[model samples]
Target: MNITLKFLLLAIFSGVVHLDTMVFGQFMFSRPIVVGPIVGYFFNSPQTGLMIGVILELMYISVIPIGIKIPPDATAATILSVVFANIRECNDLGMPMSIFFGIIFSLVYKFTDIQIRTLNNMYLSWVDTAKAEFVEKRINLLVYYGIVVSFLRTILFYLIVLPIIYFIVKNVCVLIQYCPVKENFRDIIYILPAIGVGIGIAHFMEE
Candidate 1:
């Protein structure tokens, strides 16, 4: 698939996943384990997706969005990790690094999530205003408008962030690939998933 098309499709998927957080049924499709392999399959790298998904899934398995606590965006992380791994043709040496970058992106996406929530609050305010000026029939229209805006918030985020991430990861992968100590780096990669599993187990024990 063309890179542009890949990005467009992934962006749409990401948007849908984001929207699924609230507006749609809370399907687990937004989970990293689910979204990762799907994005990986699109790039003909299911193993890469599965690997990243497992690591991320384990790492985040304890998170629960209770009250006002918004967890980091794992779906974004998984999509970006799979996309970056495909772009870099990453093997074991690159996979861990790609996942690390994905974690970072997930943190960044937390801020985006906050912004999206704020936007949704604005939508609620608009709905309140409309409720005052309009009849009961128009209430549904306002609710639908909020949903559309919520969906678009994610689409816009992906469209803007994807290209920037692609360029940065592409260059970083090139630098890391040529680095003389990369052979040693794969040793670190080998341990990362194990560490994620350990953390997951610990979290489960605590819960």
Candidate 2:
């Protein structure tokens, strides 16, 4: 893939998915179930993407973005998992580790996510304080502001995180290169769905 196109795809996916949640519509498009397949399609590994997405979807089933609660970001994780796992060099080494890294990335992103919302409160305050005649104009400005900031933030994060994570995955892939375990790692992918199901069930039961 051309380097430019690769980065462009990442930018496009992250921005739209992040905005889908942050800007307005609470549509579930940001979820792994949807993101995984689309990611796979783009990476030329539709089956792998679908599997990873479904497993992650099941894993994420228990985490809800209810009022005052911001769940770990799943969009970036799903995209990274599918894309990294499909890498020709990483082979089976990419499957589990990339997904694991992706999940960790999601958790870390939650902190930034909270900060983004906190920053957006600046906009909310503007809306609250504007004079009555200018309130609608302020609200419109804030809406666009929120969307632009959120999109840029997500893109900035990808630019910073992608190379680091890719380097880690690629290096680890080398370490696992000679291991007989490498060939068997694909089975871990098959096993993950069962684990996700268990996690979902246990989460609700413990609740």
Candidate 3:
């Protein structure tokens, strides 16, 4: 595919996916029921998306965003997975590989949360200005700042990350794929998610 076309599609897909994530947060786009099949369909690989989504869905079933749980954001994970797969030219089943990269991408977002809180605080500092603007019907400035900052954050992630995931998955994962115990490794990959759910359930039962 042409680089322009690929990047364009990636941007559009990422934009839409991010918008959904922004709207629903972790509630919808992060789960298998929505993110996996949705992203797969966007890439014209529904089956792969469904399979990956199912695995991620089941794995994170007990993830809690509240209290001390602070689970990694699954929405970011799914978006980065699809983005990595495309960037790396991986097969449709790239979720098996890319989901791991998504986790890394999410670490950047830990600071994003802090940035957002900072923005809220910044806005609070301008409460008097906000009141004046509200009375003047000048919502454009607020909208402008919100859009610009949000877009900048997402764009920074894309520029910094897309290439890294592409390179690593292509080179490193390729090497791993050839290892003697690849299947055993795959079994271990599947097992961690199963264990996560089991723990989640066990924790739930205790409550």
Model 1's alpha-carbon lDDT is 0.77
Which scores better on TM-score, 2 or 3?
A: 2
Clashes in predicted model 3: 0
- The residue-by-residue lDDT of candidate 3 on 53-114, one tens digit each, is 66666666676667534466666666666655554444332456777777777677656755
Candidate 1 lDDT over 1-207, as tens digits, reads: 677887888888888887776668888887878888888888888887888888788777777789999888777788888788776545555677678787787788789778866766654555566656565656677677768777777777778778887787777877877889878887775566787788778887883
Instruction: Name the best candidate (by TM-score).
Output: 2
Query: Residue-wise lDDT of candidate 2 within 109-137, one digit each (tens)?
Result: 78888898888766677767778999988
Cα error, residue 40 of model 1, in Å, equals: 0.7
TM-score of 1: 0.87
Clashes of each: 0, 0, 0
Q: Which candidate number would show the highest lDDT if scored against the true structure?
A: 2
Q: RMSDs, each prediction?
A: 2.3, 1.9, 3.8
**lDDT per model vs. reference:** 0.77, 0.81, 0.61
